[model samples]
Target: MTGPARSHTEAVAAVGRALAAYETQAGVAADAALVAARRIATDAAAAQADRQRHLERAEADLRACRAEPEARCTAEQARVVQEQHGLEVARRAVSMAERAVRDLAASRVRFRSEAAALITPGRTMTSVKGAELEAYLSSVGLRAVASAGPGSSSAGPVSAQRPSGGGGRDIGGLPEGFELVALDLVDVPDPVTGRDQFGKGYSPEDMAWAFSAFDDVVLPALRAGEGSEYFASLDAAEGRMGTRSYSDTYSGFLGSDAIVLEARPGGRYELSENGRHRFWVAQQTGRPTVPALVRR
Candidate 1:
């Protein structure tokens, strides 16, 4: 309660206020430093996370690249399979076409042969299975002309005639007594010399080449003829010429009988000795039967 006492109290209170202010300032400085440190730590953690994500993405890309080659290989294989299927389809088409040509050719031979057989001098008018043969010939692109025969007409113009039914189908059905002989690739003989000027002997290699030609060219040619708009009006159907097995050792018939030119499997060539000779004779006379030539 004295003046001196009051001044001392004021001084003490002032000293306390100064100490509190110092403590507050120290606390604000410490909080600011902690906030700065926290911000730095957050930024560092975000950077680390981003780097990890980038690394993961890079690894994923590397894996994808590694798998790409195999994927491409698989795609190539699929393309090859598709191409093989297309080739098989084309091969089957060719085979069917050949069959049509063979059938038509055979019918012509038979009619001519029968005509010759009926006559002593091998010259006479021959008739075939009337409606059936006519239809077949028509389908195969040959129209019957009662007015003439082979020597009687060239590929020249004749009187107006009805179109024949020569359209043929794939020969999946094997006819009785006929066998699918070896597919023969007939060679175009050297115009001057009637020999196989391309290869040596009638070995397997030669046969292979011949058959390949038949499959690739001759067969296709026959098919084209069968399907041609002009040729389709003939009556024709393909049948087995012959089939020869590799087991048969005697290559005796090669270059001999036209029928025995090639053999297929299942004893397609040489139905009988007499039949073979007859077939040979038929071929020589120009009444050639493709199937008969096969000799099975």
Candidate 2:
């Protein structure tokens, strides 16, 4: 009975030891598999992070390339705008110059027309004789008849007398005793036939033409109160008055300033160049006693 019991116990102990050893080996294998799995996971995560960095770098390089072109485009646009502004300014200046030229040309044409119309042959007077002087006086609305002095007729030396109570000032460098006289009382000396007192190089035809132009054109302008304006327009167009001597005389007379005259050898007084235009205007418009500064 002792031997059988002893043998059973020994077999049972041996079986238990073998089973414990097998369990220990299985636990070590499971720990090694878990470590390997953790390493693989860490490596995969690191690779993914490196790929993301590469993508971000590529995007930054693309943005830099695009910015260079954009900057160049902005500079080019600014330059174009400045050039366009300069071109516009030049164009405007050219336009103004052209307009000024056109205005000057138009003014010259108008002046020429006015000068041409001034001296018509029919209205001009060549001499002062008989009723012609009286008719002219009447036409100018002068009631006073001219007094016959030492040389009353046209053939003899003419003297002009100042009317009583007709007060006047010395004008145009004439003598002090001279008084204002009607346009008809004073005779216009013919440039062709008589002595040219004013040194004007004009023929009788020219004188007559000038009178006609003044009467037809200048008188209406003066009566309408456009005298100053007309002169200004002419100046602006023709540059200035008095540049031409004859033109200056014309302007002076049209201005209605004092007319100067001198007594001739005969009873007739000679017309001064300064007063020619004024005298003509008075005659045409029937104005009496134009301001006259007479010289002996």
Candidate 3:
């Protein structure tokens, strides 16, 4: 035990640090392999060209010897045959080098496909919230207890969840691109702590209104596809919301409250791991379709 009671985010961040380092090293390795393959190809072509020149010179010498005395012609012909053999060997070497380049290129593509699943944020199987986050931590050989104040215990397994209707994964769902759906279509998660923000004194309806207003403040930059700007706006909104007045009214909700929805292998809209209040607002307020990140 390194120690007890490490915060869940701290545990996840450790893995994230390792993942980032791996991504950097992988990028360097991929680039170097490609460069080496190209170099081999270039060198082989040069060698083949040199061999072709030698063969041509040998043929010329053989012709000259044929015009000389018959005795000398035999030796010249034998030397010309050796030059022809050297050219064949050089041609084979070039072919082999070309083959190596192709094999390495294919390997790189496969490596990227696999690493994308692990390293890319959206492509990762678990969002950093709710049951999925816990599941992910367990998969990587770490277990985290939700740091729920004094009597914290293991954040035991919550049911596996899916967006839309649910089936085994089908990557072919959104073959083209994202599908925009009315917020009414979104489904909020069943409460992990027995109830979501609705239980914290305010009525569910009022809490939803709060969430919707917060999202309205956060949505413009998000819709514009400005990642840094969106996150900055999100943080700003979180700060404003976390103040005593806002927090008291909004069930103590705070940072990173951007509504991340997913459309996984099925054309449906649902609240992502942390987006509970907003989904309720969507259902209650009849807000029109909003843009989503649409990760798998």
Candidate 4:
């Protein structure tokens, strides 16, 4: 074969090899996602059971406290109230876990389907360009694959400037090579409270108010099949609380936003200001890695 023809054939062979490798990696990711989904479902079931037991115990304790003379029962009553608060938090966690299990399961199926479509004969190269594969992986709730070569698009590093006016510190307990980190790590100066704040920390009163609003307004609106107004009300409440709305965060996780991370001296990572509930959700779901924009 002539030199140019030989080069062309070699290039084609290289593309084929790369595609094969991507197919294998995608298959592995899909299998792992399914396994993770099953594990999450099992864990969520156990958590729900545990929460139920705790709630029963708390109820029993409260009843016992109430039976005591009013003067003697004051401290006991306070303790029981704390227990009830804990039970409520646990219940919320259980709900989150159950939702994660469902989302992960659905994502596993979608990942498998998309991967299959990508690798099937004659469909492989269609619209395969910058960040499409990474975007698809993210859409299916899998970690973005690192680029294999120059031409392939990947989640590259972020800019070097440190975010302003926060208690910037590295967070521990992340799995090795974890790509996503919590936005709560970025301590922004709170305008209202005049303290360094990351995410909104809810007090008992805050929790009470949120739950009351949810039950009275949001829940009824949702049940009545009011869509936009329900969401708008929710957004207003979340804004007042200074927290990202759960639905917004949920959609953000499935989208293609780059998670910016800073590498510390001891190989730790600090999530940037842009990260929020997605990192927290990743931790809740026990995800091993996520797509990130590392700061060099």
Instruction: Identify the candidate with maximal TM-score.
Output: 3
lDDT of 1 by residue, 1-296 (tens): 23443343333334433433443354455446555555555555555555555555555555565678645454445544555555555555555555545554455444432322233111101111222333444576654443222211111111111212211112211122322232122221222132233334243343443333322222222322322221121212222112222111111222233233333353333233212332333233343123223332
lDDT (CA) per prediction: 0.33, 0.43, 0.49, 0.44
Predicted structure 4, TM vs. truth? 0.34
Model 2 Cα lDDT, one tens digit per residue, 23-92: 3344345445545545544554554455445445555555555578544454444544555555555455
lDDT of 4 by residue, 1-296 (tens): 33443344334445644655675588678678767767866776677677667667767777787776753666556766776777677677767777877776666555644553445331223213323544444455653334333122331111111222332322122223333333444322222231233346643333334333332233223322344443444454334323234333222332244356675564455666444443444344443334445564
Q: What's the CA error at residue 8 for candidate 3, in Å?
A: 6.6
Write one digit per residue (lDDT tens) for candidate 3, span 32-111. 99889989999999999998998899899888877866546777788889989988999999999999998887676556
Candidate 4 stretches greater than 4 Å from native: 1-11, 66-71, 122-296
Measured by lDDT, the strongest candidate is 3
In model 1, where do residues sit more than 4 Å from their true spots?
1-12, 70-296
Clashing residue pairs in all predictions, respectively, total: 45, 12, 0, 0
lDDT at position 157, candidate 3: 12
Candidate 3's TM-score reads: 0.43
Which portions of model 3 miss their true places by more than 4 Å? Answer: 1-11, 119-296
lDDT of 1 at 47: 53
